[model samples]
Target: MTRNKGADSVQSEASAVNAPRMTDKDFERFSEFIKREFGIKMPPSKKTMLEARLQKRLRALCMNNHAEYCKFLFSPKGLESEITHLIDVVTTNTTDFFREPKHFEMLLSSVLPDLHKRTNRPIKVWSAGCSSGEEPYTLAMVLSEFADKNSAFDFSILATDISREILQRAVNAIYSEDKVEIVPMALKKKYLLKSKDRKKRLVRIAPELRKRVDFRQLNFMEPFPFRDKKDVIFCRNVVIYFDRPTQNRLFNEFCLRLVPGGFLFIGHSESVSGMNLPLRQVAPTVYQRI
Candidate 1:
């Protein structure tokens, strides 16, 4: 009465489809863990969304249902292997090269010149939550342009994300041609390399610029591993997922991590008003460390 291998897989798929929707209790378990471990708020409204996202993982693991997935996710084995992946899946990493263009304009106009004048040391810029490498590579091009003009100006870029999966994408520094259209033509000409296979329509950040950025995995919920303070930090659009207290604490840490007179760039849609942090609003969604 044993089923054939194909029959077993078909039955498995059917059972997975017929599996009960994630229960209220299971959703709470996931939401609580996400909030505690990643500082990401997963309200009840996100239950359906979370359920959908995790379904793929079940298939990958050959799991039949949410219960089995939850069992493994809470186990110690999951902590080592699945925790970060869980966090990664829940995130929607929407980013673009040269996004919020005003920030770069400010970088060229004030942040760069000011920081460079303050010290002869290589200017340190950290692109927190840098998704798929756009922000950091854009930085490389702009900073390189500035250095060409000012022989004495030197800089370093640190780009980090919570997802190892996304960090790998950043390190690869490759993008579809469309992913880079926002990049200006002259800069694109200087900093992007076309794929050998033209039909693929792919481009990679020039090797020279790729060498300038160091990509790493960083979770805001963990202690920051900075050995030296940063001169400028771009954490734009990242704190919105955190609750107010988490956001406050995270910014306070960013405040402490910056050298005085350093810059912090947040998302245009986000605000830090009324927080007692030592930052002054210098432009729309841009702040200077006091």
Candidate 2:
């Protein structure tokens, strides 16, 4: 008995196609690159997860394996465009309207009320790491409601994220009906427009609310460029991926950007623990700049 030559050739090709060939060194280099460039910490335990996420990019670029992809990524030309794709692939954009409702409740109940009473000047809110416009739009809806009653109170939102792709989506201001389900009926009616293509199940945010939010591409690793300090900064669920040192640096930056006694809202799972930052916990997951 003997093996057929054609069959042997096919088997060899299949094995090469399906093989997991990302070396430990390759993983280490990519991990370091992510941490240094994006402030995201990818430990050894996340190697499998990182490989899985990057596999799609490898296929899209017609690369055979992670090693080739890594080389391409660091190449001069790849650094310009491929790095954007890499960040888009590596970062998570999981968000919904009114996510972590308690924060919004606190904003309306305590933060906004106190700020309104403090001064008659315009209010500034920064929605850092605002993915897909949901958070900022939600903020706008809440602020709009307050303005409707007060008449004289004015506010504006700055929504920023590192991923250009996500920022574009946010500017489009289109969302699925399911994405807006958490929005209260009155607010949804006021702020959302039912798309003409009802079959597509899409909703576009009203121009009034959309215009209040200024969406921009921003990397948190860089210095924030704003002349005016914010009355509130919403950086929720964005820094959970960073290590403690990175978190500390980010919190300090937030403090510097915020007005004295301004508010900072983070994810429920995140904290300012172990860091003697200039922020005091005013509510669960809510901090005020000192």
Lowest-lDDT window of 10 residues in candidate 1? 15-24
User: Tens digits of per-residue lDDT for model 2 on 216-271?
Assistant: 88888877777689999999988999998999999888898899999999998898
Q: State residue 109's C-alpha deviation in candidate 1, in Å.
A: 1.6
Candidate 1: residue 231 Cα off by (Å): 0.9
For candidate 2, which ten residues in a row score worst on lDDT?
14-23
The residue-by-residue lDDT of candidate 1 on 51-97, one tens digit each, is: 98888888888987788899999998977888767977888799999
Per-model TM-score, in order, reads 0.92, 0.92
Error of 1 at 12 (Å): 17
Clashes of each: 0, 0
